[model samples]
Target chain A: MIERALKTGGVPIASMLKRGEVKILVVEDDKFLREILVGKLEKEGYTVFEASNWNVAQKHIQGDRPHVILLDIVLPGIDGFEVLSTLKRNRETSAIPIIIISNLGSREDVDRALRLGAKSFMIKAHHTPQEIVDAVKKTLEEYYLRR
Target chain B: MKLRVHGTLFAKFFWTLTALGTIPMAISTLFLYATYESRIRHIVDEDVARELQLNSGIQFLLIFLFVLIMATFAAYIISRNISRPLFVLTEVMKRIAGGNLNIQIRVRRQDEIGDLGNFVNEMVRRVKEARERQEEISAVKSEFISVAAHQLRTPLSIEKWAYNLLLDGDVGKVTPKQRELLEKAVMANESMIRLVHNLLDAARIEEGKFGYTFQKMDFVPFLKKLLQDRTVLLREKKINLVVQHPLPRDLFLTADEERLSIAIGNIVDNAIRYTASGGLVEISVDTAPPWVTVAVRDTGIGITKEDKDRLFTKFYRGSNVMHIATEGTGLGLFLAKNIVIAHGGEIWFRSRETEGTTFFIKLPLEFSPKSPSVVSHDSFVGSI
Candidate 1:
């Protein structure tokens, strides 16, 4: 149902390119958190796609690639680390800035996610939705400036 | 009266050698006398026999002396050989009993003493394994707490965002009365979030996973800013919070600012929590070369004698304050002590029941990160 919604609701690639609207993909397992994040990102005037797990996230990336990806560390089957490494290794998705929003606040977890090529790491409980939005904006600005 | 021999191995060996020598000497002397009297007396002249008897008597005396000397020498060597290793073993055992698990008994011999040394080594190895297993179990326990706390935090984060959106009028328009209630809910939710964070930190400290990123920072303004953040709490309790001036602005220290803030903030929070309305809580800093001490004094219900001993222990609450405030997790002082000690610092308190309590945190100006094993071990001792 989520994949079908993504297929139908997502703007066409040509229109998105023509409009130059920034697209954000949120990969989170929790439904309410995903909704709030998606809601916040949509409210911020960005086209947001929600993924409950890595498979759905992979479909979103392949179908209509997002400009930025908000990744969660813990997920069913393949974790965020796997998804991050795979994306970083791939030439196509390597440039897509991925910011990790996780419940795991350990130094090891943060360092690991960053080392695996996450643009930034945010602890879920420590940051509000607004702060996360700020981080996304900052990460995107840095990404564009570096380019 | 009975002669009570102290039954030492040395003494036993000496007596046994003496007995062995004396018994043979006594039998030889009796046999020589019998033979000289029965056979030699009938065949030899009186003078010659008498001279022979005297010569034999001297020979026996010389033999007895030689045997006694040999026995004493042999017994001394044997006893020394046995007692020396035993002495070394006793000392090593004492050190092992004193919680030094890394020492090993070196054994070169293939005898009973060597067997004993090997046994001690095996025992120590097993003890070290058991201690490691215990540590692993503790790490697992900390991991459990960490994972559980993270799980709790996810929903709490969702709740926090939901509340934030509601308060920010993102969902809909909120009334003034509704905003006030929502703010209270936010505070309560934040406290719950803080509690989860504390549990995570405590677990990390236990598992020696608490990361420290130390940098040179000014101590005075850092403290002033921290106190400024707590002014609201001080105002709410109507407690007079004071920071003694003339605190050197150049009092620099190498510290993890985020962690040190939490440690100091916990101390200040505890002072605010326990202090009654219209009470005084004073914070002061004193620098003496390499050492900088921060003293937080509160004029509130002081620690009882029973609670003083375990004040820095994990999950410990004072007898007097438990009824007064039930919101404490009893982890603040425990965490404060661990963080302070991790920075090569010390934390101690002086309190008198029903009067007040003053906590002193003494930190080094230069933080030389001790090995994690040593830091965790020290914090473990502090927690216990």
Candidate 2:
């Protein structure tokens, strides 16, 4: 069903979000999952950045400003919750919309992530790679359209 | 745990009986004294009557002695009647607290003590049921390592995505051999998805999400069709699958066909799974008044005593047959047991090591007739 949504109406929205101008930072710990997400996001014409751990994620966020961030809760060094709080605390990254794509499916975790200023929460297991790409596209459109 | 006695049963019984015996005796003794006083007044002069009054004092003392003796006897009998059962009840309670749920105090009377015994029995049953529920939840939690949906599902999602990418030829044009290898990968990925899906269903079943859709239907045809489908497995193993009885002409039942099918299917699958090549499997149905019993007997490697004890426990693969067949997720029989139990039925098995095994499922003709919902369909992993 999500695939149908992406196929029917995703292209125009992808163009409208200015795929070339948009930058998305994916903060995930798993190497294989990172590659899959990167491949999907890059295919959608967005400038995608990757961070495998908390230190790299911190460095990347401080040096480069991305319009949106796809954050995962489980990480190698400092966990995703800490990363979420750090980014939300900073003035520059606080305005950037974060969509959590993690395997933490409990209601408590989802509520906590949303309360910590995430734009959306998607369970990694429930969605296809393309659907996640569509989420990024939709979040960007909503972010820009609001301004 | 300390047992709390609500009221003093022995004291209550002793006091009630003593009062019953003494009250009448006191009244009768007073009447005899009154009659004796009148007769003495008529028969004697004033001086003689005074002496007669002294004699009547002896009669009063004798009556008091008799009443005391009778009250003591009655109190002993009454207190014994209550105290014996109470002693037995206390012992039974101690046994229960020590984790023996099968003991029941013999109820012999229609008194309060009998009611207490019955109440204790009911309490033990409820405790046993609650313990079973707790066991299932903990088993499911441990099986998935606390995050069931996330653990298997994330890997399945990644595999499916990767397989889809390969099929789409996004990376490069695939050669013929590469396409064949990718197709195998797709098949393997699908099986992994199915396995994860089954695990999710088992978790849902543990979580008490049995979506049953009960309907009135003929059960004989359903059983026949189910067995007919199993012919493939039977032939592959060269096993003789026998139906012991002709389909009952009047076998109508009210059941959730899908869930019941899955439950029975799991048993039949086990029968096929454990049976050696060229073995025998028999299916039979018999009626014992209000219940219908379905038995699946297989002349295969039977369950060991240790395995039988843990058969219904979740994710419990038998230690004896671990090397025999290693593909099972150990959730099939657990799911079947719960499904049968939820349908107001009973499931058990009889087995002798190295001989054979027979599983029995008993279902009542009438059960909870509440309208069934379709929500449980999502709990199933593969196609029904």
Candidate 3:
């Protein structure tokens, strides 16, 4: 799934993928935005899961153990920073490539997220849905290459 | 308030006068009286005694005058010593009140006046600290604005993506009229994204966070891709975008490609935005030893004489263009100049009102082999 996308300019929609494998968990708070993102990712032929808050995100993270995590910084409880630090600390989930989709665009925040082991940081309003999908695919490709 | 003396100058003056005048007069008069007392009785004659008394009286008069002169001199010296430091303290207060915080009183005494001097110094320091705290708070506020601009982009990004989907027919195919309306919305969304991005960038540049990543890259592909990206704008405006220089197959330049793209893109975009329909914008380059100069000349409604001086100033929209284009935030040229200078380059422009404008960006042929940092270390020409 990842290799095909990487070969074709990293367009997630163009690359065919297996349904059960290559799971992506999206953790976002805004219901409309979460649905839009979920719709975009599902259209790209990937198995997707949604978590509206950090607690739900944690349950999905520990139980499903998704391949890639599309995380948002601002959440209802225990924001993205805390969630990021927690996942990165765990032995099982540490290898999962997490990309931060956040409204926190300050240099300090970006540097902090990157330093905490996020694969990439995306400003929510700055990127289109398709671009975000591409970012997910590119990050997945890079993660596999590193492994 | 009435003058209250901590240490009395009057007392010093009185003591000086008593010591120099009264004491000396009493001693001299007693000695003179003692020497004449025995001789006056022995003489016994009335005339001789009276003559001797007169002589003693004249001597006393001379001694009194001498004592008075010495006393006045001593009083003057004592009074000056007491008042000189007070005069110095008054001058120091005047300076501190006039916003000079650097001066400190010379606390040479351990008396009440010395304590007063130290008190003044402490007050000045507190004032200075308060001013510094005010400055720090303002800095934090500006930093907050920058961070807020970043946060503002998220919603804008969502809107942008949503609109783009509709325009691309991701949801469903639409009629020609609906497509045109959706396209307008897409353009508006794009403008918002650009604005938010520019605001964040300008704030970062102001706070010295916008840095450079130097890499060895071919300039030919970079410029080609940069211009090709803006083909839509050229098509929409029907402007003839010309590349004057035939780019070599391999034109290598040591620079930061991302920042250079923004800088050059801003210039070309501005050219397209301001120029009327069917105008010309030409991009050319000149290569010489140690310098590679890129020039962008636009046949736009050129800058006015008044606006030319402040063209690159942040948030300074030209009066002429304000009616023509209300979309600009006036940060593009300012940011472009900073990025170019950050790469050890210079940006200069020449324009005539209603004629045209030509902006030239000159970068060094070589860069420092190490990481090239930002250009906000010193105040630049574009800074307001």
Candidate 4:
């Protein structure tokens, strides 16, 4: 049934199978944006996990490591920078490609995100859901190619 | 205020000099007279002694008058020297208090007065440093505004995406009526987004954090692409956009493409917005050696007399266009001006109240390497 949905979505079957094996963890506090991102990613045939905060994100990371992480800068308990550094410092989670999806579009913020080991930075408002999904796919492709 | 201090200093010096000169001279004169009277009384007869004594008294009177005059003159000279620099220093301090931080006291003397001059210079330096520090703190405050604007854009983006998704039939097929309302909502959301972006850009420009990347580009294609992007707006308004290049060759210039586009785009957008439907916006490029000029002429409601002086000021909207286009943030032209100037170019306009407005942007064909992509905040402050 999932394959049929993927096929109807117009993605090639082989690529869909490969994408289905890839897990993406979304770390966003805003419920609506997170839902949209998750829906878009799932429709693109990727296994999606949602985390509203760093702790939840940590749990998802330990249980079943995601192939890619979509991180947001603002959070309730711990901020995105700390989460990014923690992920980068740890040997296991460091390899996973992290794409920052946030509304903080200042040059300084973008520079800081890139400097902290994010694979890509997308201004949440500046990009549509499809564009963001494309970014994820691009980051995943680059990650796999490098491996 | 000036006279009292001057008088006090003069009086103090005068009395001190007078006392020092007069008291010693008077006492010595009394001793010399006593000795001379005794000697003359012993040496000569009464008539001779009397004549000599009168002569000596006259001589003493003359010397005393000369000493008094000399003291007064020396005191006047010394006091004037001391008070003149003090006067200059006081004036400079008042100017500094009035918010002029560029003044520096020139010290010529090696005396205490010169030391005071040096101190005043040091004080001005410290004040300038403090002002810069305060400006930096305010820059941080503007950064806060930038962040707040970004936060505001987040939800707006969500609305934009959700509405777009519905319109595109991603979630379900949208009916024509539903699509029309959604389109209106999307346009409103997009305008809100534009306002937020403009606010963020204004904040960045103020803080001198608006980054630019310069590259050599062909001006014609760049301009053509920009006009192509405005097709929808042009079609909607039924405005005629005519591009004219008097020169047959392509105009080449070094610029930060994105920034220059915004600057030029602002003029074009303003022309379209202010002009009536079926009006003409003519964009023409003319080149003289080492200089390229782009003139945007519009058949629109021109600038009013009152708004003429403040056309490039932030948050300035023309009184005539306020009712016509209420959504203007008044930052477009201001940002456009700054961007153009940062490129080492000039922007100006000619307008009459009822006829039309024509904006001219003059740029150098060769971008000087001395002024890099990022313009200094001091330069911006001076421009305003």
TM-score of each: 0.74, 0.48, 0.66, 0.69
Off by over 4 Å in 3: A1-22, A76-82, A106-116, A137-147, B1-134, B137-141, B168-173, B215-217, B248-254, B367-384
Question: What is the DockQ ranking, best to worst?
Answer: 1, 4, 3, 2
Off by over 4 Å in 1: A1-20, A62-65, A89-92, A140-147, B1-79, B98-133, B372-384
- Give me the overall lDDT of model 4: 0.84
DockQ of each: 0.54, 0.25, 0.43, 0.45
Residue pairs clashing in model 4 are none
Docking verdict class for candidate 2: acceptable
Candidate 3: tens digits of C-alpha lDDT, residues A1-147 = 544554555543333364445679999888877888888888877788999988888899888878799999888757678889888999989989999998777667887899999998988776777888989878766765433
**Could you give candidate 1's per-residue lDDT for residues B214-331 as a string of tens digits?**
9999888899899899888888889999888777878889999989998999998998899899999998888887898999999889898988889889889888888998778888
By TM-score, who's the top model here?
1
Q: What is the two-chain DockQ of model 4? A: 0.45
**What's the lDDT for all of these models?**
0.85, 0.76, 0.80, 0.84
Give the winner by DockQ: 1 or 3. 1
Which residue pairs in candidate 2 have backbone atoms (N, alpha carbon, C) closer than 3 angstroms, thus clashing? B211-B376
Worst-scoring 10-residue span by lDDT in model 3 chain B: B375-384
Clashes of 3: 2
- In candidate 4, which residue ranges exceed 4 Å CA deviation? A1-15, A77-96, A115-119, A138-147, B1-144, B246-252, B369-384
Write candidate 2's Cα lDDT for B1-384 as tens digits: 774434556456556665676577667667766776777678769777766666666766786677567766776677677677777777766666666665555566777877887787788779979987988877768456446655776677778778667766767888889989988887676666555655766766655544666677788898988899898878989999988977567777778887788789889888888889989999999987688999999987889987888998888887766888766778888888888987789999999877788999998877776554433222111110
Which candidate number maximizes lDDT? 1
- Cα deviation of B290, candidate 3, in Å: 2.7
What does candidate 4's lDDT look like per residue over B131-220, in tens digits? 999999889878897888877887898898898678768899899999999998988888888888888989999887898777888998
